[model samples]
Target chain A: MKPTNILFTCAGRRNYLINYFKEALNNEGLIIATDMSANAPALADADIAITVPSIYDENYISTIKDICLQHKVTAVISLNDLELPLLAKHKSNFNNIGVKVLISNEDVIDIAFDKWKFYQFLMKEKLTTPKTFIHIDEAIAETENNTLSYPLILKPRWGSSSIGIETVDTKEELILVHKLLLIKLKKTILYKASEKEINTAILIQEKIKGSEYGLDILNDFNGNYYGTFAREKLAMRSGETDKAISVITPEILAIGEKISLLLRHSGNLDCDIFIAENKIYILEFNPRFGGGYPFSHEAGINTAAIYIAWLKNEKIKASFNNYKSNITFAKCDRLLKIKSNS
Target chain B: MKPTNILFTCAGRRNYLINYFKEALNNEGLIIATDMSANAPALADADIAITVPSIYDENYISTIKDICLQHKVTAVISLNDLELPLLAKHKSNFNNIGVKVLISNEDVIDIAFDKWKFYQFLMKEKLTTPKTFIHIDEAIAETENNTLSYPLILKPRWGSSSIGIETVDTKEELILVHKLLLIKLKKTILYKASEKEINTAILIQEKIKGSEYGLDILNDFNGNYYGTFAREKLAMRSGETDKAISVITPEILAIGEKISLLLRHSGNLDCDIFIAENKIYILEFNPRFGGGYPFSHEAGINTAAIYIAWLKNEKIKASFNNYKSNITFAKCDRLLKIKSNS
Candidate 1:
């Protein structure tokens, strides 16, 4: 088989895409690596490496474009969100240079990147999701009118890893938090302003209260839902699950199928859901693989392989039924320490 | 009156926000300007001007951050989506430096950015929306199985201004379109690959077939639906209405209110709806100010002022009831060529 020339941009050290490519293609591939950090683990294994600034930098796109042209790169895949838009911006340029960028257009990426808009879309579709609020005034009014129960959660609409999240127990606290949030938003925008500018600030949201679950799914370009894995969170930090167990509950699986039907989502995704009061509410959707996605693969869901096959336009047999029952998985971060005796 | 320092970032020569701010604040604000293009139209009137690359570029943030620190800028208001995230990212940094960013957190931005995810979130809440898809596969399967009818349209899940859209007349066309789409996605992803990476690509969506309309809304951080303007599309390019007439049909207005209640969106938003065969299908949501928004504002809806007031934590009188009938408004973009002979 002829080898495919793939350029993995923003492929961090912990990316599962690397291993999946290696295993599926039998190491018959070339890689061009670009990253902000010189010590990024993926660089050592790449065919070529270039150290660049953060993807958010102004020169990042031009730099990538030049490098792709210089090395005759074939495909570019982003392992993170910040790089996704860059890839998108230069997709046509890459095309002109005979390279492929596996991302949607700039406008699409803009929509995919914002959480509040995503919620609005979901709510508009009548999908099952936890109750959420995007406006601080609306949330405060709800609080004052006792529209929501006490012990509610507050979160920023676009934050990740649990930043700016708080649990409030009273209307006074909600009001105080709103004031603080407005001040913070104002301050941040002002800090980025020029000598004579004003500050534009942040949006506040009412958080959902419940146990969270995740669904990992892969779909083909034709928008067919090929594979899905429902995993229950055994332990979580902020909004991420540190310890999760794969559960093949038919109920959850059916729900996953329903979501797949609804969004027709292609590529890899992690669907977050909340089970509160014995009802399921989808919290959010992540279009790409999450940090701890390997657990799902270990539980017999080869999402990466399916995605690869789909890209090649090959028919894949959905064989995920083998590990469909009460599969348990766990993830932990460990810092290696040398023994004193040594 | 205190001169509230405001920073306005614009792309190219556009300074629409300057006029909006001037009109809203009654010329009581100091407007600092930054644009990548040195000849930007707004630069001439700006109190202070700085040239920077696109807001998505890292240099833009760095430049803005430095400027904010030096000037003690009061507020940062972005006129585009590209700058919104950068303002949001350094929000905390601005707080530490004593400035303000009038935007939401990155998470909120993420959800707000992606239409497919937003639709799913809304669906979960049991809100009313047109049936939509995120994948082409599901759309094709449904069509083949005789689930969907003719006159269906295909759209990009995260698209704007109606790019890459097609209307289907039959199943054969749908299949042909689906195949073409598959090839397009693969080609796009493959072209960017090096020698060993796999390609992943875009999502496909179902088209809402019917009479389409747009609704502009302004909410506070508290989630209250404060102000709204209902407009009917008179002419459209792609899915975006290039020319529209402001209308206040009770049915449309009531639907907009229901959507506002459901989405709990704040600031400026444009919600698209389809009324076909006497049924309303909430098609998609644009969480930011749209291009044709000025028309609605000119038709007696001060959505811009309402947004500003909400940002300032001031009470706003809802003006949605003012326009109770169809008010005709016209818009067109024209190019002028100067003659050297003159």
Candidate 2:
């Protein structure tokens, strides 16, 4: 049999993807990996390693295309969420070259990136979700028009890992928070903005105070949902689950199944749901496999395996019900530094 | 008073935008428009028009930033959709030099460009929409597995216009269409693929056979929805409306209001809705102004005026309700040829 030449785009280094790919290689195929950084750890594991430009840049597409052509790459895969749009955008580019891109359309990537938009989608679908507003000004106006709620949450419409998330209780506090955010945004993103740009929008939602759970699911292109695993976040930083433990909950799995069926989602998806008042309210959906996905895999979910099998047209076990749950997994990262000798 | 130095980025010689800017200039402002094309039509109306590289390129952003600093530009506006993301990305660069970008976060622009993700959002929100799928392979597999209906439509997910759109009725036809698409993609986009370039994913959907209507709305940072106007497409080519007419439909307006209320969409947006079997299903939403929006201005719905007013934080009247129904507005173009000898 001819070997399948596969290209994987990675961010920094993804040990999880590299090891999984190696394990999944039952057939004689080559795994080529590319990253912006030359020192990426995944390079050690890959058959071919190359430095590529930032995925956000147009040149990245050209660079990847050059590599695929040179290597006779058959399939392209992205390990990061942000890279998905670029991958999807150039899917046809690969197809024209007889290379398959494991992506949906560019539109799917767009929706997946924006949390507010995803929440809006849930609302549109009549799915249970926390009350959310796109513009902070609207939330303020809503508060002014009525009375009652204190301690609402303020977040950027398209942020990840809770970059600019805050909880405010009063109108005065909200105004103060908004001012601070404007300054922070100008400093970090906008640089310095005039009065007009200072007033750019934010999302305000009725905060759900409860135990938060993450559901990991692997869905096929045919809308077949599999490997539904629910995890309780043991610890978190900046809204990302740093340490988590797999929990067996039929309710959460059912919710995951419902959302997967509704989205017709393909590939790995991480869904955040809040259990409050004995009700599950979905917060948002991440379309790509997350940093904490290894926990799910450790729980015998094998999300990566399912994705690989589906990509290769191999048979997959249809059920995940028999997998062991109530397993605890820990993930920790420490910054490394070396002293320079003068 | 000295004219406020306003810079326009990535605007080609599109006179519609220039004329609208001219009409909206209650306060004196020097309009300096930039495009890569020296012969861009907007050049004639600009106080100064300079050609620059494409906005997606990093060099273009650096060049524009330098020009803004040199010219002491006050505010920057984008007249093109593709330029919006680029402008948003370089917003901080302008801020360092004391210029304001009339855009939100770069992430917002990312969300707006993707259509399937937007549909997923609609479905998540429980909003009525045409049944859609992300990939042809997934669609075909699902149809085979679930006995899904026929007469399905296919299109490039991130594409503009009706390019590569086809309707298929049978499994044999679907397979043939998919193969042809695979071959065509390889030829055009993948020429670089063997060489490693990849580009946009394809989407397949169940055809919604019915009358389609479009709605234009303007919202402010405060999430104030205004300038709501409904127009029924009189004629369309691909996905663009070649000719359209302003119509006053309470039902359509109500739908637009619902979407705006849900998305809390700030700035200008055009929502395309399809009415089939006496039901209204939203087809898609464009975050920027539609190409045929000038027709609405002609029909007494001043979209440009409302947009500028919103930007300026000026009070805007809801004039859309006064528009008459069945007022046919048509847009047609002719190729002008000149004899060099003459």
TM-score of each: 0.44, 0.46
> Per-residue lDDT for A142 in model 1?
74
Candidate 2 C-alpha error for residue B73, in Å = 70
Tell me how far the alpha carbon of residue A311 in candidate 1 is from the true structure, in angstroms, after superposition: 3.5
What does candidate 2's lDDT look like per residue over B172-206, in tens digits?
Answer: 66655554444444444422312232233555677
Residue by residue across A1-342, what tens digits does model 2's lDDT show? Answer: 556777888734455566666666655577888988554556656788888888766698989989999998877877776677667777877889888776656656666766667777777888888788756777777787774276788765553522347677777667665554544454444212123344554667888889988887667756577657788876564355655667888788788888877776667777788899989998877777666576677667666556566666778765432456666554422111111112
Alpha-carbon lDDT of model 2 = 0.65
For model 2 chain B, give the 10-residue run with minimal summed lDDT. B333-342
Best by TM-score: 2
Candidate 1 structure quality by residue, lDDT tens digits, B166-196: 5556565555554444443443332222112
Residue A94's lDDT within candidate 2 is 83
User: What lDDT score is found at residue A335 in candidate 1?
Assistant: 13
